[model samples]
Structure formats: C-alpha cells, structure tokens
Target: MNDATTSPADSALATRGAALDLLFNVLAKRVPFDDAWDASRPLRALEPRDRAFVRMLVATTLRRLGQIDAAIQGSLNKQGQQLKAVVQDILRLGAAQLLFLGTPAHAAVDTAVELAVARKQHPYKGLINAVLRRLDRERASILAEQDAGRLNTPDWLWLSWRKTYGTALTRAIVETHLGEAPLDITVKANAAAWAERLEATVLPTGSLRRAAGGQVTELSGFDEGGWWVQDAAAAIPARLFGDLAGRDAIDLCAAPGGKTAQLAAAGAQVIAVDRSEKRLVRLSENMARLGLGARVTTVAADATEWRPDAVVDAVLLDAPCSATGTIRRHPDVARLKSEEDVEKLGRIQSRLLYRAVDMLKPGGTLVYCTCSLQAEEGESQITNLLYRRPEMQVVPVTADEVGGLSELLTPDGYVRCTPGHLAEIGGMDGFFAARLRRVG
Candidate 1:
C-alpha cells in the first residue's frame, strides 16, 4: 500500500506527489513555480513523458486553484473547518486530474489517498477520499454552477483589469487565461519553410505557432539552433526596428535573451546586459546555439547602474515589471503577484526607461516594453516618460511592419497585444511596447 511497493503505477503516483510539493512551494512559500520545478529532484528521475505529466499536474492545479478550493469547501459543508495544508494540496492534485485533465475518478481518488498517506497525513486520507469521490461524481454540476473566471482570479488583478481594460475585456482576458498557450518560435530564416516543417502556423506577427504541444527540444531546428522559443507578442518589440543591419544596439535587462538574438539576427551589433551572471550565461549559451554569439557581446551588470560607453544607434529596454500579462503561460502570476508589487515595479521601470533614454543617441530609436497588463507599468509609464522628457516622442508602430497585427496597435501607435487580441489563433501573451525617438 505504501509508495515503495515497486509497482509501475505507484512510481507514476510519485510524480503526482512531486507536483503537489511544487504547488506548496508556489502557493505557500511564494517561490516561483518555475524555480521550484527547476530544482525538483523527483522530476529529474522520471522519464520525459512523466516529467511532462508532473508539469501538467502542477500547472493545471494552479490554473484552476480557486475552483479546486471552492469544490473542496463545498464538499466540506459551510462549517468552515480547515484541512491541514499538505492534505489540501493532495486533494487539489486529485481534483485537477479528475475535473480538468480527464483522469478517471477511481484513479484520482486512489492517488489522493496514496499521496496523503505517503506524506504522513494518514488521518485525513478517508476525508480526502470522501470529498474527491464526491467531487468527481458531481464534477459537471459543480463546475457548471461556479463562475470559474471570477472565482479563479485574485480580486486585486480582477479590479486592475476592469479599471484598465473595462469589465467586458477583463472577463475575456480571464477566460483566455484558463486555456494553455501554444508554443511560438522565431526562426533564423525561411519562416514559411520552418512552419511547414514544424506543422505550425505562421502568425500575422511573423512568429510560427505550434498548437499541438510536445517537447520543444525535440522539434526540428531546435538542436540545429535555426530558431529560438519566443512568444509571438514578445517578438514584436524586437521587430519594431525596421532594419538593424550593421547598427549598434543595446538590449538592457536582457537575459535569457530572445530579443537580443532577434536583434543579432537582424545584423545588429548587440550588447546584451543583465545583472544576473547566471542569466547572462544562459543568454550566452542561447546565442551560441542560434549561431549569433559572434554578433552579440554579453555584459553582466545592473542595467539601472550600467551605462554604454557611447550612445548606441538603438536601445531596447525590456524593463522589469510585474509580468501580469503572461498568466496563461505562467498561471502562478495570479497567485504570486500583488498590487504592491506592481507599484514597486513601476518605479523600477521608470528608472530603467530614464537610463535607456540617457543611453540613446539623439535620433536613436528606443523600444520600451514589458510583459505586463497594468497601465501603471505600460501605458502610464510611457505617458510619464514623455511628460518628463519633452525631447522624446512616441514612434508609432505600423500595421504593415508587424505583419498586419494592426488590431494590437493602440490609438497612439504603441503596440499593445492582449490575450484577447489573438484568441482565434490560440492567444498571445499580453504585452505593451512603445518605440520612442530621441529628437533633442
């Protein structure tokens, strides 16, 4: 009955337990879900198939956490007796598998009890079994009765979205977050060729999107380094520059450098800088893989404090912000980020933008962007920057330049891609990018 029984199924159950542990790290300890995943010894021991399953278990649990909790509370009655934390996480893992991931009821319940017993919460095994069994049996009715979007989203994010995008769009945005995002990649050349080979669709924004999920590293062109994974929306900021051939550009705060690769692909002599040496190492590795290391120079320095030797022809400042726009891909953002975090990030963004402006040559192009939905970090940041520096003006992005993604363009010509914009195409991450020209 114990996990050490050496059965293949029990070995699989251990993967589910690992997922629950990751959930505790994110929800209770406030560690980034990805960081927890990266540090998982259990995951490394599993085959690639089971490793993917563990990732699915954690992501599905977080993405539907509110609904899972509501289901638990409903099963427990209105009395409000709280279960122990470990027991609750085990139950959530079971519920997610049953209700959302098409796991059979018996397997779901059995795994919940097994994980509970394994983790020394044997006292709650019977209770967990009862609740999960009830939930599985009534999964349809329970799910239908709930307002999943409202229940799943934290209140602060809900209010922020409503205030910034209004009620209708806010609902749409949250609805989109419930779905999994497709894999999008930017190719070194011959996008159409790569799309055909990869069985992907070429997006209007020039990135190829793969809806059928698989191991990205296994895909063609991955080992060859002919392409790199970049979200379709995230690819827009780098493309704002029409031509960077032989031009000098600085990618500030650029680690895990997709944008830097794009700039280098465009023939820009790129100086990619970030404060984290570890991140810079990854960036360098990625650049080497893409055959772009020769075009880029790496520097590990705090972009806020570091300055280029002279003004560059172009500067891409992907400022740090509460990455609220990426909820679909990083469902933990809804649980991990807070309103205070947004305000704090806004100040940091301001400082980075000011420094970016200072580093730009007169008439040099500066692209300021963030994977954030809050106006404080995106629209308002630009407004404040313009008000303070009269010399800089918004350089309107055109529909033609971004492969006809005109709907994502704001009235003032800044590129603002929301989750709702490309819903028909599996949706892209919400992002805001503004190209500015330094006239003074």
Candidate 2:
C-alpha cells in the first residue's frame, strides 16, 4: 500500500492511516487528541518507532494546521475544499511531512496518494497527490511567507494573549508553542545527584531537563521511582506552602497526582482530592511508586464538598482550566480549546477556590493555581476571590520561592510562569499560582 522507498511491508501506510483517523477524530469530531490517540487500536498495534512517527506526524499537522490549510487552499484553487475531511487530513499530513518532518517528496507524495486508496479515498487521490506535490515543490516559498506563530495560533487566543501579556511576550509564547517541549522530571530528593547520574541539566526550578521523546519507562530512575515526569513550572505551586512537614495539605483536583506527589514528598499529611475515582486509583499507584503512599490519602469526591475532619493547614487548588498554558507540549490544545472554554473553566476554578479556603486553618495557606495562559482562569479568578473573601489576603510569592526568578512574581504577589519566562533553557509550561493566607 506504500511506495518502494517506504516499502509495502513498512509501517508507513499503517502509521499514516492511523494518523488520518486520529486527525479526523480530533479536528472534525472535536475529540481530544490524547483521548483519540489512546483509544486508537491501530496506533496501539504499531512498533514504538512507528508509533512515535504517527504521533509526530499528527502532532505536527495539528500544530501547523493553520499553515497547512493555507498552503492546501492555495494549491487546491479552492477546489480541494470539496474533498472529504479525511482526504483533507491526508493532504495535511502529506504537507506536514514535506514541510516539517523533512520527508522525501516522492515518499510523501506517493504515500499520500496511496493513503487515499487505502482509506477508500481513491476518488480524491488525484487531489491529494496534486496538493502535496505542489506543497513539496513550493515548500520553501510556502514557509517563507508564513507567519507560523500567527497562523498556527487561534484568533481568540492570539488576541487574548496580546491583551494579557502584550505583543512581544505573546509572540514569545506563540513561538514557544511552535516546537516540542523538553522532558522535565521532579525527583523525590537529591535532585542534583540524580542530575549527575542521568547527565541531565537541572533547571533553575530544580527540575531535571533532558531531550524529550524517549520512552520514560526506559529511563534509569523509573524502576527505583527516584523521579517522575513533571514540568518545572508544575513543581512550583506545591512549594509555595513551604515547610509542609507534618502540616495538613489538600490537593484539590489532584488527579494523576504530580502536585500531590510534591506535597507528600515535602512531608505534608496530604489528602489528594479529585473528582474522578478512576484517576484517584492512578494517583495512588503513582504515590506507591514514589514510596509516598503512606504520606498521602486519596479522596474520590468533589473537592468543594469534601472536607477533612478538621480544617487543614493548607490547601492547593490546581483547578481545571482551558489548559492553554500546555500548548507547547499539547499543540492540539491550540486547535481544541476556545475562549468560551476559558470563560467556563474560570467559573469552575472560582468555585473550587472558595471551597478550598473553607478547608484551610485560620492561619493556613491556600495556593490557587491553574495551568492556563488565560488571565480569566488565573489572575482574574484570584482577583475576584480576594474581593469576595476579605480574610484571604495575598501572602505573595517572593523571588526566592521560585528559584530567585523575580520575574515570575506579579505585582500583586502571585506567581505567573509564562512559557516565555525560561525560554533560554527550554521554556517551562505556563502556570499561575497565588499563595494566600487566611487570617480572619
């Protein structure tokens, strides 16, 4: 089903076929890319190398979908618009190969045409072949005129970011999203020692950094549970509560438990609350791997309604948001998330925050955080909370609290880690955390 160069037996055809299905699902059906990726039977059947190819092909197509479509429209003379959605994705995948992955033109064009046949898209094979060939030929010019950062970013997000961080920084954030993020991991202790052993660079926030795209399980520390994968920015919010030893801490919305691990590792008597029971099981499994299960308890209930036996020392609400901040790693978020989604999540985050405060001790700390680049979900939520709850005063994050990076601190004393904050050393995810003290 593929060309001689690609080999009839090579996984190229199977991989692209899977990519098309996943892409069609994500773009047309509005299914999340990760969900689709996980549920894809064909994807699961491939060898790891081919699986990685499928992932990169689909991810690259999603990331540059704007430019790919623009190039397609240009090549199609508006005629290709009549092509089937899957066929369109086929062309998009082909364009991604030619322009981004540096796939050979013959292989890229041939496989695309062949892919159409394999998928019963034979009628549009001509269109697919023509469009991809044109893209391959004009690849240089197509790239030359493209404002990838602008083109790839959704209109709502581009404007929202401009208003929030101004043009230059917004551009930086968009630029950061155009590429893949490096792998960052948080260790239980002796991060420096782990860094030396793994030959990984220790980021300023003390997270270890290495080139991403390897099987995480294959890493040295996976078996020992010495470290777990986490973004440098994600490891920060939990640290805002300093000296958690023997203090009570609640990690609301804590599923898949990255922040929960940090809290328990800090010696906090942690109650990790999440809305999903299934995810709680996963969190418990992770804590066990980290040898932190004894220090943490999992609660599979709505954090707003689930209170501890007594008001705890601190609460960390890593509330759900549109997740625009993770665009670098999950480029599909740029295509999947909307301004309306941000508005909706902001309401939920606020509700969760109000409840988290109720569970805090009189002099306890409450750190509200979100992995959202939208101010509505981060800064605005905190602002409104302070207005409604007078007792919840901002304790303010100092430079030392976040690796002496004073730029991470807001004038109002919150911690705002944008993708552009640590751009020099492979930027971190965008995270907003505000430490508050309930002293009524």
Candidate that scores best on lDDT: 1
Instruction: Output the TM-score of candidate 2.
Output: 0.96
lDDT of 1 by residue, 1-440 (tens): 23344677777677787788789999999999889999888777676777888898889999999999999889985458788888888888998998899988888888888888788888887799889988988999999999998988999999989998889888888999999999999998999999999999998888999874877889987889999999999999999987999999999999999999999999999999999999999999999999999999999998889988889999999988889999999999999999999999999999999999999889999999999998899989999999999999998999897888688888999988889878877888999999999997
- For residue 86, model 1's alpha carbon misses the true position, in angstroms, by 1.1
Q: Per-residue lDDT tens digits of candidate 2, residues 132-198?
A: 8888889899899999999999999999999989999999998888888999999989988999877
What lDDT is reached at residue 339 by model 2? 77
lDDT of 1 at 256: 92
Given candidate 1, what's the lDDT at residue 309? 89
**Model 1: residue 396 alpha-carbon error in angstroms:** 1.2
**Per-model C-alpha lDDT, please?**
0.90, 0.88
Task: Supply the TM-score for candidate 1.
Answer: 0.96
Error of 2 at 202 (Å): 1.5
RMSD of 1: 2.0
After superposing candidate 1, which stretches have Cα over 4 Å from the reference? 1-5
